[model samples]
Target: MFKIVKKWREQGTIERARGTGLENKKTTNNEDATLIQHLRAHPFTTATAAAQITNFPASRRTAQRRIRQISDFRCRVAAIKPFLTQQNKENRMGYAMQYLIFDQNFWENVIFTDEKVFQSSRNGKIRDFVLDSMKHILNKTIAVVDFPLMCGPGLVVGVPDCVGELMVD
Candidate 1:
């Protein structure tokens, strides 16, 4: 597919201005060009986890060739992934997409919300926390938790100390 597009480009089928980084090139489509431009603007280390998430189809041999020839695809995927993640978090889209499709009768009038607090250590050298199954297993179990508190209109709200609050059995 890309080869065909490249031939078309070389044969003057598509015309576009080459950016400073792109030099002169041909692409499979406008989408491919967009993807590549995004990549060049945002380069990624070959080891980045988002690469796995994006599921780029080419193999190592193809990567070496393509990285040399089609640098933009690599750049676009890397740049856009982090931006996508940041935007999703800002919009609360990607965090927890849990759909609880349950029996209506049981779920009626049930509202669910949660809160959590954590204690941290000082050795927080800034690095991206790479997530994998093993990491999920290691630190995710919680023995203590809390839910949102509600007070009636004109009622005083105050924090209770170590005893927490009334435990709803």
Candidate 2:
């Protein structure tokens, strides 16, 4: 039964297989933090179970090494306590109160406002930074940022030197 479980661990059916050290292998794109988080919450029954969590082919020895790596980081346990503390849940209203303390009229006089946004149709600010979305969307999407160049005289009203601003949160 042990050997059979070990074989399953090696095959990747079980990601957290103990003794394989496969999970220790540095991933280029790290697994979601939730994976590590799950392990902390539940100790697995078999090496096969450990192997299953890793999503990598792992043998008993590989699983052991990976478990060691995970264990080594357990020192971070102290930090998690504070991070998850109810104190963290305390009201963040100090900032909100301070904001209220300020005169609203002063802000109205300044004429600046902040906002958040998503993909745009006639409205603005998109940077694919991944691709030049401008040519594709053109006036239709408003992606490549400063396009429709809000600067030229043809534009009307309180717009700035740059194109329409896209507020993001």
Candidate 3:
């Protein structure tokens, strides 16, 4: 408290002075910028991987600290999102236009169902530094449903043994 009052009386402001703390001994400004650039290009790169790939002379802990110092990046769990191509978009538009004339009564007879595959044994606690949460990362794999198969009459769902390979029952 006495030191705080003394500094306040001396500087006429309570705000701390810039560049008063200890300097970084492991990495320099240019190296930090290079690390940041590498992370921006490949957000999934782990701290150790980034250090190795960027040829950072410091340890993995220093590299991690550098990443944490940057305000624009954040480590978060990736979200699942379906990726659509141009051909897929066109097909969807055509389907929508074809069904545009259908009335509410006609639509009432239709049933929509969605299926998602969950890996019970897989650990999904992976975290990556990303600039935007809206953009999908490569960590989460997305399998697109081409067309629904008809089994009996009630509802048919397609099961995938592997990605892009669907089996119907």
Candidate 4:
């Protein structure tokens, strides 16, 4: 209370003074439009790469800040997908076309199997900036493990403390 009173007495108002810094030149409307276009064209590019590709005059950190200003944009872990060659793509398209005429009852009896290979490494995941509308395009998979049957006093049928064992099992 005393500090507030003293400050009020010293200054006429409690308003903050203007900052003594130059206005940001990198985040202008024209530069923002260019950055947005570059991101849309290459969503997986890093901030530094985007800045370098666009020939941005600002630092990489500034480029990152500008990216954050855009709405519905978020940095997320990249989905790992198998590399599909041209022949693989054509085969997948042909398979899809063959199944296009299947009715709901024909698809209802379909059984899909999920198989994932676990890797022991520290640098397996990759990060990327993505638009909100593009999230559904990414593939997401989770592995669920059920513990071996236990009939003892305490039957713990869940994941164990060891991550490596959980993945291996």
Best by lDDT: 3
Which of the predicted structures, 1 or 2, would earn the higher lDDT when compared with the native? 2
Per-residue CA lDDT of model 1 for 1-169, tens digit only, reads 7866996878866544557456643334453344344333333323232233334454444443444454422221211112235554444432222323446774443434333222222322212221222222222222222222343111112223322212111
lDDT of 1 at 111: 39
Error of 3 at 157 (Å): 17
Note the clash tally of each candidate.
Answer: 6, 29, 0, 0
- Computed on alpha carbons, the lDDT of every model, listed in order, comes to 0.34, 0.36, 0.61, 0.57
Error of 2 at 110 (Å): 68
Clashes of 3: 0
Order of quality (TM-score): 4, 3, 2, 1
The 10-residue segment with the lowest total lDDT in model 1: 72-81
**TM per prediction:** 0.20, 0.22, 0.44, 0.44
Q: Candidate 2, residues 31-89: lDDT per residue as tens digits?
A: 42333443443332233343466563546555545544554322111111123234432
TM-score of 4: 0.44
Clashing pairs in 3: none
Residues 1-169, model 4: lDDT tens digits:
7766777899966655566345446456777678778766555556677788778778988888788876466767756666657786566556546655879886554433233354433445444567766763332222322112223111112222333322311
Q: After superposition, how far is residue 109 of candidate 3 from its true place, in Å?
A: 34
Lowest summed lDDT window (length 10), candidate 3: 160-169
Q: How far in Å is the alpha carbon of 120 misplaced in model 3?
A: 14
Give stretches of model 2 more than 4 Å off.
Answer: 1-35, 73-169
Off by over 4 Å in 4: 1-8, 13-15, 18-26, 79-125, 136-169
Each candidate: RMSD to true structure? 18.5, 19.5, 12.4, 15.7
